[model samples]
Target chain A: MRLERRASVPPILYVAAPLAAVMVALAISGALIALAGASVPEAYRRMAIGAFGSRLAITETLTRATPLILTGLAAAVAFRARLWNIGAEGQFYIAALATAALGGAASAGGLLPGPLLIPFLMICGAAVGAMLLLAPLALRLRFGVDEVVVTLLLNFVVLLFVSMMIDGPLRDRMAFGWPQSVRVSPEAALPKLWQGTRLHVGLLVAVAMSVVVWIIQSRTAFGLEAKAAGFNPRAAAFAGVPIPKVLVGVACLSGGLAGLAGAIEVMGVKGYVTTDLSPGFGYAGIVVAMLAALNPIGVVAASLFVAATFVGVDGMSRALKVPSFIADVTVALSLLCVLVALTLVTYRIRR
Target chain B: MSETLDILASASLWAAVLRIATPLLFGVLGALLCERSGVLNLGIEGIMTFGAMIAWLTVFKTGDLWFGLAAALACGALFGLLHGGLTVVLGLSQHVAGLGVTLLGSSLSYYLYRLAIPVSGSPPTITPFQPLKIPLLSDIPLLGEALFSQTAPTYLAILLTLAVAYALAKTPLGLAIRLVGENPHAAEAQGLDPIRLRIGVVAFGSALMALGGAFLTTAAFNSFFPTMVQGRGWVCIALVVFASWMPLRALGGALLFAFFDAFQLRLQHVTGKAAPYQLFLMIPYLMSIAALVVFARRAKVPQALMQPYRRGER
Candidate 1:
């Protein structure tokens, strides 16, 4: 009998592979922890406790997860359409700036009520975010420019622009010369979900958005066209689907979601923009999107899991004195492992 | 207006341009080899970090600069091997594999550095490479000071660019590599192993990238820090496009970016609180985007770039 590669493997393998990949990633992280002179089991226990051991811990996890959910969705939506829009980080920065500028000005002016102000700022944030990708999108469609590098380079430009704003125009004179934007008006702030906890309505909004995305992706004709464009662009173009329009639309939606995250972050959490506000949330979003296999509902689960790692690892570092970067290593390893695992699930050995 | 003129007339400003361009030159050349071999090594950012850390750590330990450089080169080759295995052997997606390699390199370097070096107090320092004045050439006026008096790596970068330009145009090995990149099936039909050639080129290119990283620490700053590479690797990716995959053109692109970078740093001192220096910092990045928009239509990218080669597959 000759061995051959089968076209498809059992469906069970798809589910099992990611789970195995997670286990392998955790195991590798355990070794890293040991190298850092921490007891793996003790550190892990601390992490779990930090992530979900108490109501306060759970709230903190959700709080940390709010932006992640949005960014993850951003990557998923764009990547699903093969748009390669890696500038979510820059879009998030742009949105944060827009939110801070508009929210602070409107609130200080008492131009809108609290309920109205928050929604208005968020909408502006999303709009600005979408606008950020217009150049990259145009270049990609018109000139066949590689969106990946263009998007990546744009991240730096937007970040520097924000830094300039914070240092110059947006500086709060009342705050004694800090490199930060003016405080947003209390009216523009996102209301807390729980009065006693840091949890805010932003979490609810993120989850709601995920459901909306899931419906759009699974139930809409546009979603079908997006899937077709991504999997086989030539075929989609031959079939008369507006490939360019679909890509541009998906990029806008992705950028909008990411911008919403930045707005929520500023309005709900930071209340101002700082240079170090995001700890690579945009980059981590790629991992989250890939781990979820670009499924909107699965993005929710992936976001929460990644959020827990961030929260848990902070505690692990404090208790075990290990460097928190081990968490990043784990996430990266999981990405590589999942890719391999998924590839395995795509093929079977036939005799 | 007079201050601007003075800044332009200063010898140091031009020297700074040459200095700033040195590491970027190494990176652009490194990326050139990989892209020319039909691989997009987005891992350049992370691999550079590995080189920087290894070079700093090795030099800090042994007090030997060459040893540090060697260690960095080895680490870069190792990461390139990892990228090659994932993309060439396993037939994984180039974009994902490249990003994965980047994440792995960056995080691993950070973790290892934290473990090896203590966090408290000042970081260990080394006597960084000092500029060597060329005997007769240093006597020349403006150009000599900017070009002749330089660190070893700066000179090496120039030599390497010329050597690479020559190799790509003149050598049979270069032709074989180009053949594999352009049309692997055709290369295979000529009895050349496409996968092996791709892997070899990737490894060689990555080794050059690692050297560039080492130059950042050992020659430029004498100390390594996380994020010091600071998107230069990504800039090199853009430079590849800007140069249209030509080594000589990449040299010009690298210098153009370096000039803006050095000028930005100088402009910051004169224009303090008047203009946002951040805008000046954005010049190189913005120029790159502008360059892409202008030249992307004309740039002849390698035919098989970003595609995985598999035997007997259509």
Candidate 2:
């Protein structure tokens, strides 16, 4: 007569639920696509083609996915530890600014070797992100402050700081009055993965990081403690898990991944920092991580799928004159549908 | 120095502060109601956006601001129902559900706005609600003009805050709500339906939030733009914490936040290029964060807040 949690859910449900949820989202968004004056099948076809039809298309998709992968990992790592680190966006900004500042300063000084600058800036960016989350983590642990609000508010502060940095202190003097920072030196730029494509070594870095995350999540003692803390903090604490330490560590790693995403984007694609550098990649990461069920390896696949939708929708807009915002609607729809599906995965109606 | 004093002393600035405070007041009260009832509707931003768009579209089509307001309230109710269903009925994670609502509300609103108003050189504008000056009260002084010379919704918001405060303090219904929020099991044992109570409060609160959104278009700007809600809904969330979920305190919090907001706009004019306006803009948000840091530690949050009430689960 009431819903009850399944003692052991069928393995097939794990695979089937996401597929069904995606199909439902697609069916719904398909109707929207039709309303946008494009044939649903044709629009979807265009999307597929734009996303993975060619080497260039795929490279673009993966290029777009590079940041999503890192951000997704960021969310996955933190959410797995039950830390709602919504400040990934803010951390990304802080890291982007830090990397840009370092690169800009290094270039100005012309002291560091060009080859070493990339790694140096990347570390500095990641360090800044970790450092930023520490304050919020401390506040949350020590004073019971809500990290959600703190993190979300920090986004605005960091974004404004970025705007100020680009427009005032870091304004590119050589560029003809664009609201952008100076481009990083060529040696600092991420090397391309393939010739004649925007895809860069960042994808490889992302993949490597994904592997590292998978190993840490599945094989490490820290990961076990994090999982325990996430599931039941009080029980975990009683079981001798250091919940506070685990939370702080997870937050730092989560922030670091998001920070690395920002740094990679700057080095690989833009070579400079702009106000519109991220199109909500950090926010999108939450959806990616959720869709992956906080599985580290799953994050890579989830990132690619999300990136394809974004890039494909852009292409659809260009090809069909449909507003690319349909992508956002679809993503939002999918997130809700997926959550519903996830609920059905664990519990079921009983009679 | 005298010119600076003149600007700060202007009745117009005070009026601007009140004007800015209106939407925030509506949103804060809405958020307060929901949080008081043990549901954190993070969808406030989204609901407000949806309300503003629906209201703007309604007025644009029918040329009646009253109808637009009604439409906005209805839209809010629908979103509230959706959120309540997800968090209350379905027993989903409130955090995820609220975020989903936000994402859906904003994107759908954006999509609909695009469809409703085609992209053109300039965005379409409508006849916004004009300020109505109360005869004797508006003529009294700076404070009088700032308080009395306002739109209809602004007056409604203030009255609603007082009413909410009184209801929470005095009414049996309010007592039931507080009981369910503070301890649902006790209320359940008393034969009260926690789910229904939570849903009702959420729906009503969402309607007020929608009015707040509608205010942005109808009274504040008279035009709709993409992302125009611009984190005001988020500010309301922070203000609820700042106010400790008390309605009258919310009034003071909203106005205090609005004062900094209004001051920043004036400061931009005075300091223009001399000081970075972006940094000036950060002051309000930073202050909110600081307020949260100081106040939230001791703030009396509902004991059952963010916890889904499933019957028979002790």
Which candidate gets the maximum DockQ versus the true structure?
A: 2
lDDT at residue A153 of model 1 (Cα atoms): 91
lDDT of 2 by residue, A242-337 (tens): 899999889879999999998988888998888889999988998888888888888888888889999888888888877777888888888888
* lDDT digits (tens) for residues B185-218 of candidate 2: 9999999999999999999999999999999999
Number of clashing pairs per prediction, in order: 0, 0
Local distance difference test values of all predictions, in order: 0.87, 0.88
How does residue A240 of candidate 1 score in lDDT?
A: 95
DockQ of each: 0.63, 0.68
- What TM-score would chain B receive for each of the candidates shown? 0.97, 0.98
Q: Identify the runs in model 2 with alpha carbons over 4 angstroms from their true place.
A: B1-4
The regions of model 1 sitting more than 4 angstroms off are A1-5, A348-351, B1-5
